[model samples]
Every structure is written in C-alpha cells, then in structure tokens.
Target: MAERRANVWLAAWRRAVLDRLPRNREDAPWLWILAAQAEADLSLARRMAIVEVLRDGRPHPAPDLQAAVEDRLGEGCFGAQVEQTLEADITSLRAWSIRIGCSDTPGVGGYYLKDPIVKAMDKPGYEEHPNPMQAQIYRSMGDARKMRSMFEMFEFALHQVGIGTRLRHPDWDDEQVEAEVRRLVTGIEPTMG
Candidate 1:
C-alpha cells in the first residue's frame, strides 16, 4: 500500500511535468497517463526547484524553492500555502529519489539531486508553455482531478446529510432518507420516485 501511494505521487509529478514539456508527438489524449504511471520523477514543484538549483550549481534555500515553483506556476499566488507545499514536495522528492536508487548529496545547503535524476532534469526546457495540443491535455488532467475531488467531497456531504435525515425521520427507509438529503444538497429532485 505504501509503495502504491508513492507511485501515485510519482505519477502525479510526471503528469505535471509532461503538461509543461513541448508536444513532439500528437499522442491520444488519455494515453499520456499511462506514460506518467510508468516513469519515476520529481513532482512539478520539486522538479522546478531542482532545475533552479542545478542551473547555477548552488544550494537553493526553501524561500528560493518556493519562489521558483510559484514562478513556474505563474501568478505567484497562494500566499502561505506555497511555503508548506514546497516543504512537503522537497521532503517527498528527497525520500522518493533515494528509494528509486538516486540520492541527494548530504548538506543543509539545499536539497540536491544526484545520479539519473539529474539527467531527467535536463530533459525539460523549463521556460515555455507546451504546444496547444499538450496544453489541452494538461487542462484535461486538472479538470479530472477537480472532478474526482468534488465527488469525494460530495459523498462525504451526502453521508452527513443522511445522518441528519435519519434524525428527522426515524421511520423513513434508508433510500427515502438519502433521497431527501440528496434533494436538499443538490437542489435536484430525486429521480427514483
């Protein structure tokens, strides 16, 4: 289970990077997901930070890492969340790189990339948007993630509302209770009856 979670994260990072890379091939839309699932690389923010650190062969501190990620993200928004996110992304990347046979150099100077991970870093041309087709793929990925999150949240909300419905009507059947909750929350009539 732990390994699977690590893999999911690695895939997420790969998708983020692929979204930025130039589109050399006009592959089918969803097929790139398979490619991301197969490769191990840094997450978007960590990859961006690594590139900055490698460019000048200097240790980039946390603040620099945060700014580099936000710059790549454009707008540089998100306030304090960017700091916490950068910290987690760096920590996850360091552990992931080691597990995948690459290691970071020892130092408080900055998190460093070593071995083939360094080679992967060199592949992305960091300063431009992907071609239009690839941009569409990236947008689709983001939309899918958003929809997944919404479904998860919606399920949780429905569960809570079902509990409330049960409280209000002890004699109601489970289906009836849930339908009431669904109707209230979504403002849509239950279609079953």
Candidate 2:
C-alpha cells in the first residue's frame, strides 16, 4: 500500500513537471535534459536527506525522520503521503546496499543506519573520484530547478482557482475576484475597499 501511494505521488509529480515543459520539443532540446536532470537530482536529494539524518548512528523515530527529511528538502516536497514516501526511499537506499535497520520497540526504537563506513565504498570506482566542488554546484542547480518548479506549480494552481472564481461569479470584477481568492487562501475576509 505504501509503495503504491508513493508511486502515485511520483507519477503525479512527474506529470506536473512534464505538463509545464515546452510543447515544441524540437525548439527546446534542453527541456527534456533539464527535466531529467531535475528528476534525478530531486531523487538523490530525498535519499540523501534520509541518509544524512541517519548518519548520526542513532535510532530516529519515524516522525523525527519524516520531519528531518521535510526540513532538508523543504515542506511539501514529499507530497501528502510522506511516511510512505520515506519508506519507499528507505527501500531504495537499502537496495543500494545502504544497510538501514529498523526497530519497533516502544520508547527506544526507530530507524538507524548501520556501518556508515561502508557507504563510502558501496559504489565502485567512485571512491577516489570525489568532486566536492562539482557536486556542490550540481546540488545548487538542482535546488534552483526545484524552487522554480514549485513556484510554477503554485502559480498554475492560483491561476486555475482564479479562473474558477471568475466563472462562478461572472458579476464580480477583477478586484472582487482577487479578494475572494485571497480570502479562500488565507481565510481572512477582505476589508472594504
């Protein structure tokens, strides 16, 4: 069930990204490249966030791990089913030989990374090819792409809501519609203008 939920969330996210992309693929060859890179970067960010949280070598409860991931990747990045997403990510990490352990003991149990030293050697040929500067730059680009995508999604949602508001209240002017939208978003009534 959790894996299914995570897959659904990921598919929706990918669809959103693809929908916002340019229609003419020939005109913008880099569009697909950028989108693919962004997807890869975001995936890495999610898994790395989990790994970083567990790097302390202590048992972190599910809620703490979830909160830490949200803090690391920004809120809403993991979608609504965050626990499921985290579980999916952990599963992916373990597939990569990450050795994550889980405990169910009440008050003294959670998830933790075992043998952090092995992480460095998990991937062959990359142990001596570390490039901190390049990695930092790539991460920065990924972060920028994520922020831009998020803002684009936000703007699209707001535009749709505005359109709906206008359609429902054809008598309302632009200011009135904007006010209503603001009210819907913030739950605060617009003052008399």
Candidate 3:
C-alpha cells in the first residue's frame, strides 16, 4: 500500500512538471505531456546526432544511432561513457502524430521523420530555427494560443466551480451550463435564463 501510494505521488509530480507547457485547451493534460517531452528532446544532443542517420527517410543501424548520441555528448566522467537512449526519444516524436511523425524499419531498427512535416520544415527558414521541427510546430500553434487560453479558462470554470452548480441542479442542461458559465465569467447572473 505504501509503495503504491509513493508511485501515485511520483506520477502526479511528473504530471505537474509537464502540465505547464503550452498546448491546446481540449485534452490539455496529454497534449502538454507530449509538448514538454518534445521540448526536452529538442534540447538533447542526440537530436542533432541522429539527424544524418535518419535523414534519408531510411532506417539506419541501431549502433550507428547510439554512436551518434555518444559522439554528440562526448565521453562522460573519468573517461567513462554515458549510455545511449536516442531510440526512445525518436519513438516519442513518432507518437505526437499531429505535430510530427516518423516511420520505423522493423528489420534493422531504423527510423525517419514522416514526409509531410519534413516538407513543412524544409522551407527556407528551416535552417534558421533553433530547432527546425519545433519552429514548424509553433507555426501552427501560434494561431491557436489565444483561443485555447480562453477556452481553457472557461472549461476550468465549467468543470471546477461548475460542479457545484451541476450538483445543485441535477437536471441542468446546456442552457443551465451556459448560464453558470456566464455568471462565473461576469460575476452577474443573466437577467433572463
């Protein structure tokens, strides 16, 4: 029981750390998790290390990727080396299908980014990006920032304090939800409902 409680607490801690990053308001928690993971990946030296390996849209050898990450990070403390974990990060990038995607080769464990995002990022400013893929993603997310923020705020109120209104009026419909929403927003009940 104690061990399970600790695991639960650890999971919540991880969730909170990743939750603050920017993402769509709808299904925000999972979205933020993906966004934060991608952002952290962008910072990893292995990201650049495997670019060439994965560049041709063909699978490359797993050892080649490990060596790339090793070379990128350089030898670790006391001439010892750090381990390679680039494969997992690449797998995660594949999971964020809307922002980016990838295809993996089963025979030799090779991978490459999906075509569309590569094409999008291949535009003129691609080289200029601190991280080209992230820049490409920001292009789409930029348009939705304000709207997502507003909707997130409204959704929070609707399910948060709105829970009380729901409990108070068990038969409430959209009309009631909208009424509570407006009341919460303006601090004034609608003149007519």
Best by lDDT: 2
Predicted candidate 3 versus true structure: per-residue lDDT over 46-109, tens digit per residue? 4534553465565455655555544444433112232334545565445644122333544435
**Best first by TM-score, ranked:** 2, 1, 3
Ranking of predictions according to lDDT: 2, 1, 3
Give candidate 1's error at residue 110 in angstroms: 2.6
lDDT of 1 by residue, 1-193 (tens): 4235445544565567567766743444554654453343325434544454445444556666555554444334324576676656656656666321222454435544443334545456775556898667657777778788779899999889888889989999988887789987897756743
RMSD of 3: 22.2
Query: Residue-pair clashes per candidate, as listed?
Result: 0, 0, 0
Alpha-carbon runs more than 4 Å astray in model 3: 1-43, 76-84, 96-109, 116-193
lDDT score of residue 122 within candidate 3: 50
Tell me the tens digit of each residue's lDDT in model 2 across 1-193. 4334334444554566567766744555565564455455666557866887898787899889888876655666677887888789889999999999998876558999996455555556747676899777657777778789778877776788898999999999999999888766656657774
TM-score of 2: 0.40
Error of 2 at 173 (Å): 53
Candidate 3: minimum summed lDDT over ten consecutive residues — where?
75-84
> What is the alpha-carbon lDDT for the whole of candidate 1?
0.57
Choose 1 or 3, whichever is better by lDDT: 1
